[model samples]
Target: MTPITEVEGRRLPLSNLDKVLYPATGTTKGELLHYYAITAGVLLPHLHLRPVSFLRYPDGPDGQLFFTKNPPPGTPDWVMTAPVPRSDDPSARQVVIQDLPSLMWAANLVVEFHTPQWRSDAPAVADRLVFDLDPGSPATVVECCRVALRLRERLAEDGLVAYVKTSGAKGLHLLVPLVPTPSEEVSAYARRLAVEAEAELPSLVVHRMAKKLRPGKVFVDHSQNAAAKTTATPYTLRARRTPAVSTPVTWEEVEACTDPGQLVFLLEDVAPRVGMYGDLLAPLFDTRGAGSLP
Candidate 1:
């Protein structure tokens, strides 16, 4: 493992990643960091950056291993390294979010910034939504990507947007950021939306939740559409074998693939290929004031 990167008063553990390769596309924790720094560098011109969380694991004899979503501050130019963890090995895992404040220092691009037009006074439609998809299953991920993309398009057409992030463990999250609407109402609206979506895309997707019913398709799981329900934050470094950073991507990317191979990425990777930033899906939270429905 590598030594800690010294900051103002505290020394932050930076690298000595404890991850196994993902085969042909397998990447080292170090490579992941590089990917992030490169990506963050691209966004230095836009977006408001935030703190990072770090997921650490020990690399057996190698000592502590780690990865990150947000790396600790003063990361020594961003080398991928993690504090050693306690376990055999995680096929995948959560690393960390660090040096949060510094993320703003690196902001440069925007994906869907509309702060100028945002109006909080508008009636709160459905705020705070979570779309829980499956992660362990590649088929589920693709199925989910399809459902989410369709939702994004529909929402966009309706003048609403949704902020998307991965579930980090098994699925993707399509968070419709509303201005704090009641949870039940939001959940109700979500159910309605799900019904409509399922009706429209019955051949490719389904909203049914019973395991016996899911077969091989994705479930919208509108159950997550309830209030007081918070989805895992995007790019949150989690605990696991290989640390998968939750990220937001383009609608096209979501539509083209369902492979976990294409799903997760380092926090650094989110902004680069994007060449922009902003919660494109932020508008979905605004509700139409329709009371909760059965």
Candidate 2:
């Protein structure tokens, strides 16, 4: 067992450093923590002011896993938590990630994935709209690129700028930074875009959420735009077989991606990619809406 360490003024009691999460890659818990530590600079900005939901793998990735909204018991008081009101009970408090130390604390819990809401606390406003492209089997990521390109064109017609990334699984995520829009307005706008996409490419894209109907097509899930709804934060590790990361990529790469593997980044790739792209999603954090069209 490795001893607990301090990071960003927070004490993290980390253990089981050698526990393997990705069976195929043999990626260990310590490696995961180190990855987060090294990439914290780029990753923290996206996580800042957002409530984070965790996908925990206690034993390992292949072992029993659970999703958690509240911080687990024994969470240090130093880990900043947001008192987000729950949907079922507006009075119920849901803890969200506040800073780098809090995020590192989550890494100690073996949080394999970090999913954050679209809005931040300082403004409690939605700064971006997300379009989640969930593809059913036989559709593949190649199909997602085709669909995303079409959606990008549609958004451009409305004078909106768009960016994209692999979901780090079987899909893709498209984001459009907005000028502090209401949650409902963002949701409505995303829904409208999804509908337009489906109407334009009936065979390639579908806006319906039903899994039964999504086969051979990309399901444009605009619902993630709603308050409290989350999409995996960029650079978050996916609890997949090979340690795939939710990575940001350029539209040119999306179009050039022949297979999803080309975009499936891992722990080692984080630094280089961050250096190359320099926080590709930074526009989402710019409240001035510099890139958004007037």
Candidate 3:
């Protein structure tokens, strides 16, 4: 018989508890679940009312990976879902994890949690803008850090406060909170900023998506601000060889980062960091105080 666990009055049958999900570190599914449970206080706020897309590595990081926007077949009746109208299909529905039990249910199957810039209730409006600073081969997170610092300054000049985070891979992500604005406008503004950054730092920045142009430069990926695009949600574990989380970082940490390894945060480091820093990206939730696009 499958062992059942009760989380906040919701009974969930968890499978393969000891199954290794991060082969390099030997991190198991049980540990991943624990990480989600512990960080729920901070993680849930960002996910609240947002439709999530799951990146699943059922057999571990080395196995086949797939992306699913809709809830899986066995998803419980109590799990909340919201309709997301697609250009091809209007009846499509996506899972919304509004509470602890719902999070755990998703965590059991998902290695990475991805969400759009807008919430479920207002899918056409963006509440934040994001720039994914991806460093190319010879360049590393160190290069991304330099680019992020410069971008932060640029956003500041425009009266927008930007927050930095690790991508849980090799780069960094910078986010700017915004008052509700149309997704197209947000995407346009982000694109404009990317172009400006490329012009200002022609030697270090590339705004275009072509991989050939990325070597020795940080690609300022502003296309994630699009309505259909999604970013790896903060606090979500990446499906790398090891269990590193997409973690929020202080500008001080970003500034002090000299080695790429310094920005890599594992699952074990998150809860303690949350205890000490209490959600560095908390300001993103203040929708009323969010800055308007200039």
* Highest lDDT model number: 3
Residues 77-195, candidate 3, lDDT per residue (tens digit)?
99999999998889999999899999999988855899999999999799999999999889999999999999999889889999989999889999999999999999999999999
TM-score rank order: 3, 2, 1
Q: Supply the global lDDT for candidate 3.
A: 0.92
Candidate 1 lDDT at 95 equals: 22
Which parts of model 2 have CA positions greater than 4 angstroms off? 113-124, 290-294
* Candidate models: Cα lDDT each: 0.48, 0.80, 0.92
- lDDT assessment of candidate 2: 0.80
List clashing residue pairs in candidate 3. none
Query: How does candidate 2 fare on TM-score?
Result: 0.93
The backbone clash count of each candidate, in order, is 66, 0, 0
Order candidates by lDDT, high to low: 3, 2, 1
How far does residue 213 in candidate 2 sit from its true spot (Å)? 1.3
Question: Considering lDDT, which of the candidate structures 1 and 3 is the better prediction for this target?
Answer: 3
Write candidate 1's Cα lDDT for 167-192 as tens digits: 66566777655555555676766777
| Stretch of 10 with least lDDT, candidate 3 | 104-113
Candidates 1 and 2 compared: the better one by lDDT is: 2
Q: On residues 2-91, what C-alpha lDDT tens digit does candidate 2 reach at each position?
A: 687877776778888888878898899889989998888888877777777788877776888898877688887777776777657665
